[model samples]
Target: MFKGALDNIPDRVKVFLLSLTIMFCMISTVYANFYIGIDKVYTHIFYVPIILAGIWYRRKAIYVALGLGLFYIVACTVHDSIIDPDTILRFLIFLVVAGVVGSLSRARERFHSKELQAERAFRRVAKDLQLVLESTDEGIYTTDIEGRCTLINVAGARMLGYGTEEIPGRKMHQLIHHTRANGTPCPAEECCVSRSRITGVGCRISDDIFWRKDGTAFPVEYSSYPIISDEAVIGSVVAFRDITKRKQADEVRSRLAAIVESTDDAIIGTTLDGIVTTWNAGAERIYGYTAKEIIGRHISLTAPPDVKDEIAGILGRIRSGGRFEHYETVRRKKDGALINVSLTISPIVNNAGDITGASAIARDITENKRVERELQEAKAQAEMYNDLLSHDINNINQIGTGYLELALSAPNLDRGVRELLDRSLEALQNSSRLIHNVRKMQEMKATAGKLAPVDICPLLDEIRAEYSGARNGEVRIDLACGNHTRAMANDLLKEVFSNIVGNAIKHSAGPVHVGIASEEISLNNKTYCKVSVEDNGPGIPDDLKPKLFSRFQRGNTKASGRGLGLYLVKNLVEGYGGRVSVEDRVAGDPSKGSRFVIMLPASA
Candidate 1:
């Protein structure tokens, strides 16, 4: 209150008031010297005014001292007093008191002014700091050197379920950090905030917990910064935030990684350069290498020598963001055994959708490949038997025909025997035709002949001559094709026409009439040569036509030979990238005739 009143007075008015009080004191002292007698110590009354003037005016207080001194001398002189030593001493004392009091008072006033300015600045700074702490999302608080809470921001107060008024001077650890996450007691010595104050070092705790007012604990990430003053630790400021969501995300990632490690197929991850980055337990089991032995190595370690370029190609595709699905290839195991594997590979993309690496899932297919090889070998063996049987039967039929021809030419041969020999030779020729068809079928299975352009007109004419002579002029073949008509075919092209024409002549009742024609046709934006062989023979039934080209399908159940002719014709045509089909020469007239059509890629 005294300081407040002093602050309210103006400096000039204060100085004037002190001057008046000093003048009155001096005047009273002089009056007392005369009335109250000089022996009564009335001069001491002069000390009060002099000290006040000195303290208020500083060096200017000397003028007041001199004025009072002159007054006393004048008073003595008026009384005819001698020049006394006591009077001189009294004057010197007054001047000394004024100088000392004024100097001390000036120093005190300057000090007081500086203290008030500092106080105001400190208040402004404190207010701004409080605003920052209250507005932040993180909880912030400060504790004294003794671990007692000295200040807590609004956020901190609310976070711990306490009011700011209730938190001051409270033991910080006991208030909100009293227990560990595992429900165990946490001693103050173990508290990071308390430790920071003692150690004078900052401490950060990420996997700890802080309890709320409701006795519930949450995961927290916090740092304790020691507050330092005068090179000593005074207290600590703690800032903390909840990190429950981050912890949950980490858990989910760990679970997914565990699933990948436990799968049965080898799951491998590699960089764009084919350097292995991740190898799971399945990869260890299948590749015979542990994760420690394989990771950080090149992925080519598992590729066979002949297929090293295959790994490079796969990596190239992955770099281009390509995917490979169920691609069967061969890889080498730790024991140097080649194993067939089916691999599914995809690009590993980052969050920004940039391809950074590749991931592959490989399934061992060694057993499957083994079974496939066994099946192919068995099929090849069966075909070999068929080829051998057909070649031997053909040779035997040729020899039999030779003997029949000899017997027919014998001059003394009986007429009935000669007729029998002729019939037998015809039957032998038919048997030879069947054997030849079987051999051709075996050849088709064994190899698909290389294709080249062959003129169809001349080839058909040659086929007609061969069949007409073999049939003893019993069939006539008519050709209606351009002179330069050509198709992509192989040597098997003649067999295709032979089988169809033979069927026509053999099934016909009288002299067979077969017409062969060729034309250019377009399909699927590609040009093809279409050859048609129309015959005036008993047409195939609708029910039988569907299976007519199937192997071992005979026109009659009682036929003398296996019916592989049409089947072999179809296989050979398709081998040259052509197609074959049979239909009625006259639509809806099964008894009228049948037409065999072949379509081959047209050659320029």
Candidate 2:
């Protein structure tokens, strides 16, 4: 093959044939008329191809061309006379041409070969670039300023669910329509691609949904770079990627966030540096700070001053990818009120299982604190009253029983003795009634358990029977309770009625009337039952009514038993998911006496 390439050269070498023709013509002209100067036109024919071939071909080809020129000179010289001036000049010129062409041709050949190699290298690079662009998984498409598709890689075509025939000349907008996920058109009027095409380079539109040829929607992220030539935007190149999975994950995250914000518990998130990143609606209501005010602030701002070290430790643990559970602490609200909150904090992590930040959920226990304080105070008072009742009632019973024993043992007892015995019996019964009242107050102090709905009527009847057994002839007990009476705790209901009836008998100079009523009311998105116990006795003093339910407090000093009778009544009434307050029966009826109202939760 190599020999064939050279064999195809013309039969006569260009240099030899030209040189021979020139020498023959020169010799003939010299002989024919002894002409003085020659035009030397044929000399040029010999020199030009030799120089060109030397610049274009390799060293060997250049030497062959020179040899042909030498052969022509030798042949022409043999036929002509020796030592002639014209012949000498022709030979000299031929020698000069041969030397210049041979030397320069070799150098030129090397330079020209190097240049050709560079061109080939550039072509290879271009081919490689095409392969890379075509093979990438991400879709690549370039467009012109007129919104026409200028180029689409194989990946781009496949991404739009199209073949090559459908893509090359198609307009970009026609092949793939742009719209919001909600189906709103994202046309030229609102498209960043269109806007950037008219304005400048490096503009982008994110979170857009592209409808493919198959009529299926997919999320896309695209960046457009305007191609400028001579200070004008000739076209744009868009690099796009499918982000359907990313968008779906974002939607799921948004839904879960909404659920957390809707809950009653406070939910919040912080960065690795303990900076608050997110705050929910429940946090707003509990902490008294709006999301706008709290986001991006340090989480330490919500922590109590004393708990800063504690919070720092917790954050350190979270940064180390540890979870902190049920850490009870006091958090300060925007209003400067200290809140008792139960906190659960955990490390928020990425797919690689690296700690990104921390998230916390807090539950408010302010009302629970208030109830605990009230309970403690009620307990202290009950113990004091119980001690007093045990002492006073026992003393009273001992004296009355001692007098009765003396009368029974005396054989010849006088009328005076009988009268004294009757008086003693009456005093003993009064002591028994006071002791019964003390027992009811003790029962009230018992902690309430899980509540179950109970009818109040039967509970009150029992109180009536217990009180009737102990009452002296001076007092009459009556039971007039509404049939609809219902409440949560049976023990609380009994305590309430017992305290009220006992109070009436202790303070009243004569007959005491007890009346119980119930009704329904709406509160906190639920219905509740309100039960009121009214008594016809000397009304509670205005100054004492406010603290009527306070510990170690008594309505009347002369009344038997400890002061906790009323306080216990109040606590028991409120403890069983109810509230109690004392008011006059008839606004102005101080004479008509005191009425205690109680509110209880009812079944949904």
Candidate 3:
């Protein structure tokens, strides 16, 4: 404000000249001393400028005073005025007055210089304070006792969507804090900021709403304090900032805590060093220990002594940013009873993707483990019982079949009775074959992956010959292959071939023609020996072909109704890292018989 008032004066010289003219007019026209002062007023015109310059310019006024005296002395000589004693006295007196003013001017100039230096320092400090006010992110404003804005910094003006010049003297609360967060009006008298001034007390409001010029409200955390002087509240200063993100963070934390408390599986949080940092309600229920007994303690506190080291090892891996999941182990309860649990550990990482800790979820699996043990025991008992029954049944079947055969060979036996005997013996034979296939299925499991290279050309030829002889009618079988096709196989490879060929012969309406072919094929950069056996008998239906190799598949299943031959073939072929599939011999035509294709890993 002082700088502004000084700027109104256009020139310092003009001010000095104007003031000097005024002083001369008064002194020359209106002054009269009791002792010849009227005549003495003539020299006073020169004295006025000298005195004025001395007071303003300090010792520099001496030069101006000397120039004026020389001009006056030269004018007296031209104007014919006598050089009287009193005239010399007046000139000397003028010189003495100039010296006296010069001393006074020095004192005044020093004082004025100090004032200017202090003003410049104040401007610099004010500039720094303005920069600070404009540069901050938080809003800062002050209000008078009447709740009208007295001053508002640049940040506060921008936050309220108002210009810095426009905010002062307006009611700040109506503009920025009129509406509550619940969309209700807020009374100025009830406002905390107003009360801070009216009551001379301070208040900190963490959750509130402040409005912008566009009438949008956002979450705010603000502090308000009375601006007091001499024990009297004059105004208030309020500082505030947006707290939207902080509020959202708090809400998310609340929901997560609820989930942790409500879970049925033990959910726990641990530090990298295996110290338990959090334990949920589920953890308490599963471990029989409350949160108060567990948190801040080592996780190994709950692990039994035998698995304590293993638990430490898992925590170590998780600390290094590894995930350990679904590990089944045993842990001792608070009551010293042991129970099985499936444990999973996952690393918890910060924004930098550095693992700081781990979360562990544990679910009890004692009942599942108990059921699994009982199932295994039941299967073993069933196997023993089957072995005993099969042994005794086979002996009875052998005796019955022998007696039927002897009766059929008797002389002059009726043809119908002989046919009955033949069918009975065949039925017994089929039963024995079924039993043997069941035993073979079990034996294959015991010797799984025990494969050796077997040349299949001889095996195919032998099955064709054996099946052809067994069929009474004209049954033709053709074999085409490389000279020697060796594949990874055990002795059971012959059984696979025998089952397919025997099905063709048995299911034929009359004379049937079967074709067998073998070749080498490449798949995924590996060599596999491929073979296809197709028959021209009444073919299988498209729908039934999928289940043709499964157990107890009868007329439509390429397997005997009471036998497990084809099912055993599927298991055996797959166990050798091979596969078996069936299709119609003629494309899309099931009545033209079926084709069984097999692929096996080629022997090296």
Candidate 4:
């Protein structure tokens, strides 16, 4: 009770109380000196307060001891009138008792102060550790030897969708991972903590599942380390995180790998320095080298010796962020035979937008090259034969016409013979026209870039005059023009209108009337010259109009043409970036006549 009271009292009050205690001891000594005999036992009576003061106030007790000892001496001197050995000895004892008690109490207080500081430091360290554990993103938890959860951080509780207060004191496997990823029951024996305890060693599980409070599960990768105490396995500390994104990325990578392997074109990956990193199955067939032989080797292995630096040059361009698509080159197979390949190559960029490598898709074009070569050779030979035939056949028709004309010119010929010779001459003339038309068609094709601006008005006037004198003036021609009419074409533009007028004259037994009109028109934001050639010859049959411009097709059967005249017109106009179409001169009345409309790109 006294110690408790002293604890609540302030230092000044304690000192005041100690001073009263000294006064009480002094009063007792004074009363003894006056009322009773001054004895040796009473002389040292102040030692009692000294012991009390030392117990309560430690080193401060010396003042109490001095007060008691001084009052006793004054009382003795007044009573006995001189300092005695007993008084002196009593003062010395008071000092000795106070010193001894104060030293013991000071030492005790220092020890208690150190102990209090150590306890406060321990609590501070524990608070800091808790904060660190809870602040981390990865879920951290501990389990006992029985696989029960004993401690969990806030992160762990939040990951399991549980409150901090509700997480601990439960079986860890049953709380967050009750079932296997396959949905089968997971026994406690298969738990990570249980296994850790049994084996007395730590283990890591990279792929697993953890259940949430809502009964949904997500992929997790966790590691469980053993918690050792006294050199014995006690529990486990588990650290885990969700790995759903990583799993999805791996699946995408796997699908891309499958597609790359299944394709028929060679898909190759190489480092920016030309080192081959990946070779798909198609590459194996094209290069005659298996993936195992090609991968990790230099890309130059497949390059022909004639172009050994080709692959290195491509890699250099790729490193500079260049792409080569449909680039044809020759490559050497494992058998040392060269093959043509079309390559579409691009740079491979990483997430940081840095070009790391190159991807190339190569298609074997060796067979296509061979077929192209054969076609070109065949075309050359055909052109040669066509040139020879046109030359020889024209000469033959000229000779035949001359012989027939000579026979018709002979005097005194029979009427029937004269008629037969004239008919024969006409047949030869038609044959000569057919050969000339064929040569014109071949010439247009061979001179693809021979187009220049030609005035349509001049060509129309020329065609009109040339046919006006034909067949003894049996053909009538009319011309219409716009002064600004001009088109991009070769000299073959005259033949187009001439054929129309000639067709009208040849297909009619009487005078043929042809109207040639030219005007400038605009179509699809471009300038063009539209010319309509209306002929009064027997109109084209409706059924034959669609095939009129094709080979071997003719107009009305009664006045059928050689079929090449209008076909030639269609080809020449189209070659100059124009269109040609034929329609009934009178709408919906094919018997009236045919109107051929030709639109040509107008030159500025």
* Reference-based TM-score of each model: 0.50, 0.48, 0.71, 0.70
lDDT of 1 at 493: 85
lDDT leaderboard ranking: 4, 1, 3, 2
Candidate 4: residue pairs that collide = none
Best by lDDT: 4
Question: What digit string (tens of lDDT, one per residue) describes model 3 on residues 349-456?
Answer: 999989989999999889889999999999899999989878888888889889988898899988888878888888888888777888888888877988899998
* Model with the higher TM-score, candidate 1 or 2: 1
Candidate 4, lDDT over the whole model: 0.85
Candidate 4: residue 475 lDDT (0-100): 79
Runs off by more than 4 Å, candidate 4: 1-188, 191-194, 197-200, 210-218, 226-236, 259-306, 309-335, 338-364, 401-513, 518-529, 536-551, 562-578, 600-604
Pairs clashing in candidate 1? none
| Tens-digit lDDT track of model 1 for 438-497 | 677656665666678889988988988877744566688888886557998777788999
Model 3: which ten-residue window has the lowest total lDDT?
A: 32-41
**Which lDDT tens digits does candidate 2 get at residues 1-604?**
6333443566467456545654554455445433544432234444544544443343434454545455445544544534446645654665565556656766655676898899899999989988988888878777787888878888878888987567765667755766667877766746666667788747777777667788998888888788898999887777788988888899999999789879989888989888888898999999999989989899888888888788789989988878867877799999889999889999999999899999999999888888999999998898888889788878878877887887768888888878778766756865675576656655655545657778766776777677763455555556666546566776556667776777777777666666666677778886677767777788887888888778867776455444666776777766776788889987966667888877877654
> How accurate locally, in lDDT, is each candidate?
0.84, 0.72, 0.81, 0.85
Candidate 1, which segments miss by more than 4 Å at Cα?
Answer: 1-264, 270-277, 288-365, 368-390, 407-431, 445-449, 557-559
On TM-score, the candidate that comes out on top is 3
